[model samples]
Target: MGEEFLVNLKYSPDIPHSVDVIEAGGLTKYYGEFLAVDHISFRVKKGEIFGFLGPNGAGKTTTIRMLTGILKPSEGWVRIFGLDTGKDILRIKEDIGVVPEMANPYIDLTAMQNLFLVGRLYGMRKGEIRERGEELLHLFGIYDKKDKKVRSFSKGLRQRLSLAMALLPDPELLFLDEPTSGLDVMSARLIKRIIRDENKRGKTIFMSTHNMGDANELCNRIAIINHGKIIAIDTPEKIKSMSKGHTVIEVSFEPFKFKPGDFAYGEKIEIAGDKVRIHTRYPDDVIKEIVHYAEKNKLKIVSLTSRTPTLEEAFVHLVGDESE
Candidate 1:
């Protein structure tokens, strides 16, 4: 594990047993008269991947800035590693890494140089910087381009380099804001894989993104925020279950001749050529009705499947309600 290769720091083992790795109480932020973040409270346990999910302008970045000591909260407090953010900003920064949204490395500097700069800023010795920088570059699949100036790199490569820089310190807590925001599939996949690998090594991660698929795959628990307020917070399964009572039935028929309205049991139905999606509270009732209709019309069922609401659906349901 990468943790084994990280520099050891003096940490007391006798810290309070109930201290969360990250905690916030009534955290709020404002810009003039406009509230950027409403009073919100949450805690991130040690070694857990906590996701902050919301649409753009949902105050996800604002909350992260305050927590990371880059911004002061208007009416609350945040503690990291049991140290108050306001009182121990420098001490807390040493143990944390942050990759802000669309962060860019020094364009004129080579990738290796960027890492070296970050390492020096953190007061790492020259030998330590070179060795660790090489490891991080290789891990992020950018070692081959380490000598190339960042200005010539593609967006995906730049993003990868940004992450590599963040990891240079081997931080215990990582704050990533939209890590995979705008990247090709391969690049996004690579970033997500690294996140999983890091989590396996017992690092706590706090990620903020609007990408539901990534949130579902990577997050242990997700908090949905909108309009500067958190609407829900729980495991993905529990959040999805909140949209219960509606089962989605996907069916394909050989004949492919069926109108959505023909299925009376469905609360909503969507038809696309040979495939039909039926949303209903009673899956059995809907399935029976479809089977009977198919049999009567001599339409053979090619395939059928049923699924509960997905996280995306739950998000839409929750955010949509809040918007109204």
Candidate 2:
């Protein structure tokens, strides 16, 4: 657990120079017969924050693991800065940094010790480690508690330490999986600002997240995955425009007794008294389904209206079935 606490961030990996920081070609993975990731291919240019988005079990994590060399792919190939991920994984990782999903710093050690452990593992001299580590601690606002045992730290503090450790080496390429998955509001904001700052400083970032707002704001381009495949890939503006302001339908059923499962047309369902507010992309289909359900149940239709989705309501809509 203590060893796993080592975090890394890079403005450059072991590669001295490269145009595309990451090149994945037909990356695929399987757990025996169950395919976790299909033939997904993409390129991440240098210095841009690329977002990976998907619903639960959509192969985002599997892809990241393959990119970072944590898990070997079942098929296909990947290159990091022109170096083959399958062959030169160690070299590719030498100067890069990663903050895995829910990554944690060593709770058993002090924050400074955790940093030192990670820095030494990266082959940094003590002086260099101290200089860079202290700077990151100060930058992350954890300088005041650098000597405190991380076991006593809050979740937010542990998260900040993880990022600090990752950036200790000043890497040029960074990979993060759900960097702000379960953080407090302030912590999340602070980490997001740091991520943007890193990218601004010419560091290439590959980040996977479930937060649509985060993806829309932090990523220059995004790829949405579903069912082990790349369903969509485009700039956030273009993607949001595709599903802009999801169709919202407000219907009042006379019976006022319908389970949420009774509707399949809506992505989200909420009920209050006689009203059911459904958020969906297919408003017309949902409306028809509501009418049909009411007729079949021998109930009267109180009222039905289609409401425009708010700008803030825009989120990437998954393709295909809604399982999981």
Candidate 3:
């Protein structure tokens, strides 16, 4: 298996014990009169990529800001690596890596210089900063452009540089906010590769993203938040299973109309023109039943297909009410 596959695989040892690297207790944050986050509570285990997913203005960013100590909560509490963020805000900040949604590397400085400044801000010595900067730039495939001013860099290049700056400290927990946003396919793939590689080194990740594919690809578990609340939180399979038990099979035959009475397959019948859609847990049973019924009724069954629900479908099903 590839390294990406391995990083995403669930191992017995990967299960978390009492030692949660990130824990929030009824975390609520308010901006003026608006409750941006409402009594959210979850624990992110050490070395696990816990994904927070939602649409824009869904309080995902607010929760992240509170956890990272950038914004204090109006109520509740957050603890990072067993240290209370409110009490040890400065200490927690020093031990964490953060990649914000925006790539704001110093526009005037070269990529190397930008990284050097980041290392310095993290309190690394001159030589250490220089070495780490080079290593990170190289790892992110931006070493060749190290001397180029960030202003001259492409959107993808700047994103990679921002990620490198975040990784400079080798922190135990990394926060990535829309890490793959605004990047080309190749650049996004590179960033995803580094994320997996870092997780393999036992660094936990807290990712907030609108990209479901990225969350499904990288996260061991994901929390879907909306309207300042979490709607679902679980493994991808479980979350998807909550909405659908089995695939829906659709069959179409020659232009044949049917009276409501003609379709008698219990709970598995939706008639439209020449097609019938069947909803059932047993694909084989449905196929046999449909075939038998069609044969008995002297109707020709032209085609049949079964399709599993996609995560997008599950998300729509769960959040469709909120959308309305």
For TM-score, the strongest prediction is: 1
- TM-score ranking from best candidate downward: 1, 3, 2
Error of 2 at 255 (Å): 26
Off by over 4 Å in 3: 1-18, 244-246, 250-285, 293-307, 321-324
Query: Which candidate's lDDT is highest?
Result: 1
For every candidate structure, what is the RMSD over all alpha carbons to the true structure, in angstroms?
3.5, 8.4, 5.9
Q: Model 3: clashing residue pairs?
A: none
- RMSD from true fold, candidate 2: 8.4
Better of 2 and 3 by TM-score: 3
177-221 per-residue lDDT for model 2 (tens digits)? 888889988889999999999888878899998887788779999
Candidate that beats the other on lDDT, 1 or 3, i.e. the better one: 1
Per-residue lDDT value at 241 in model 3: 69
How do all models score by TM-score?
Answer: 0.91, 0.75, 0.82
Candidate 3, number of clashes: 0
Give the 10-residue window scoring lowest on summed lDDT in candidate 3: 9-18
